[model samples]
Target: MVELNVLVADLRAESAEIDALVGGLSADDWATPTPAAGWTVAHQVAHLAWTDRQALLAINDEAAFRAELAAITVPPERMDELVDAAAAEGAAQPPAELLAGWRRGRDDLAEILERAPDDTKLPWYGPPMSAASMVTARLMETWAHGYDIADALGVLREPTARLRHVAHIAVRTRDFAYLVRGEQPPAEQFRVELTGPDGEVWTWGPADADQRVTGPALDLCLLATQRINRADTALVTAGPDADAWLDIAQAFAGPPGDGRDAGSRERERRTPA
Candidate 1:
């Protein structure tokens, strides 16, 4: 298991990376739409900021978090509506205000996590998570939403070792992915082997597992985060179950996502005369 401090440090770094990306954006730039259907750059940042606030509540005041959760009267199936509503409310703020809130919220969350006990279990939308696991989840969201912001800005970010955290959560949530979709995961475990940016192989599951997914680490991370469609990735699968898993993989909690459409990246990259 990774030390809690290390995970918190990585989470801080990941948040900083996204902060730099939006720190200089013009107000107009904040309105630029990203690949997430109706979400703009502002919406992406707002979502991250809102989620950070939720994380703080979970950590510093569990009763408040529970009360907040209980106050939500939406049916489980429509829970995403609340998520979208929160982002919309935050995005409605002035860009400078939104950015400042995000900065303050994330920084405060990081400080709280750093002081949290290693065995601390935080309540979340999904399952309760250890302090380390919560930080990992936050890092995963920062990277995933940062991709949306980068895409909206027409910038390409180089993959880094931080992706290992995202990929690890994705692999660990394989069963959760299926469960959320009203499906049962295969009883057999699937081996996932990814080639990282530094050429290191990051792997999970039994070495002798018949079901296997092999691909560039970036592709797996993007696919798991639903930032890229399976057809747009170089991921390879050796078993029927493995192939099926790739189609519905998601690293985040909540309802199943409608992943990016095939060829969306190609379309975005096209230079029209």
Candidate 2:
């Protein structure tokens, strides 16, 4: 089992970094569009701040969290408006104050996680998961949204070799494979090999694994989370699950994303004639 402390340290550093990035931005920059579908920079930060707070509330009050979770499935327009409203509120405060408040929320979350018992049960929007899993989910959320912020600014944010954190979630998205098939999930662990920055490749699962696959961690993360298409990158597969991953690979424990296969057409357009 991974140490919860490692996760806390990473998040503490990233949250502060994220706050500074948002705090330094001008009003125009706040309104600038991010690569994340239909979200502005403010929306991105607001979601993070809101989510961190929600996790805290969920940890202490599962019933209230479950009730609120039900509203997440409401009409798309309503959800959009809700998120937009949160962004507006976040952006309304002074930069330093906003940053201070955001840091406070995340730090408080870290404290809650520190004291969380090993067997603690957390309520998830998708399914019931452990407190540890919730912490991982928070890390996953930070990376994904931070990717969006960096992309819009044309800056490359390098998370230390700890991408193993996000990659683990991506690899575990095996069940999401079944959702694409429109069938029940199969009880099996698929092998995954993902190469990270500096050409370090990480492998999960047994060496003699039947369903072999190898690829860049970026592609794997993007694909599993439906941020990019399998065909859009150099990911290779040599077993039965190859085709399945191509069809669907979602990491977040929820309904499939609308962004899947987004870059496929552009990817094909860039191919040689």
Candidate 3:
């Protein structure tokens, strides 16, 4: 059984950490653009807050949430464009109001997930997810977007063992990656082994599996979240599906993402633009 309460606690803690980071930023700082093209820091936070509200609706009122999604009228191929436009609208609020809205949504989400029945599935943009998976997905998004804010502010966050949750979801979603690309999922389970922040080995899949991916846990999480391009990281892959999976390993639900380019090269190109 999934320890959903634990996941909820982690989700709450992740949101709190991000809240602390953004809380001290000046209005000017909040206007800084992140690596995500055309999205400012305010846009990042606004997206998180908006998604949180959607998640709450999914949990509490599935029919209403689905109706709302249907009303948006964006085609599958243009979902990202729609999100950017929606985020711009959501980002119109002042920093304080944005932060408050984010905190309110985060707190409400944690509370609802905590009280939810363990076996119940929550509706989402993609397939419905269990309470555990839902909270974990929220935690994953918190960490990923938090990275964008930190990078935009030129602050490097201390990596944490909490990344284990993300890595777990990333490994479990291997097949989803292929399916999202309209490709058939390989009928093989590849081993994944990552060294945690504290030098502990965290692993998934069979010990003797022919296919394996091994890397720093943080790199794996960043790769899964598409924060860092697969080519930029020292992640090792040794199988047919392993490399292909890296090309499309997305932990979150949505259409496929255009991941970042190599780290240093991307920075050089974008910093002066």
Question: Per-residue alpha-carbon lDDT of model 2 for 181-208, expressed as tens digits?
Answer: 4767645556788888779989888777
Summed backbone clashes in each candidate are 0, 0, 0
Report RMSD for candidate 1: 2.4
Off by over 4 Å in 1: 267-273
Query: Which residues of candidate 2, in runs, are more than 4 Å off?
Result: 70-98, 186-188, 260-273
RMSD of each: 2.4, 4.8, 3.2
Highest-scoring model, TM-score? 1
User: How many backbone clashes are present in model 3?
Assistant: 0
Instruction: Report the C-alpha displacement of residue 77, candidate 1, in angstroms.
Output: 1.8
In model 2, which range of ten residues has the least summed lDDT?
264-273
lDDT: the better of candidates 1 and 2: 1
Give candidate 3 regions above 4 Å deviation: 264-273
Candidate 1 per-residue lDDT, tens place, 142-236, comes to 99999888887877777789899999999999998899999999999999999999999999999999999998998988999998888899999
Error of 3 at 134 (Å): 0.7
lDDT of 2 at 84: 62
Q: TM-score for model 3?
A: 0.94
Specify the poorest-scoring 10-residue window by lDDT in model 3. 264-273
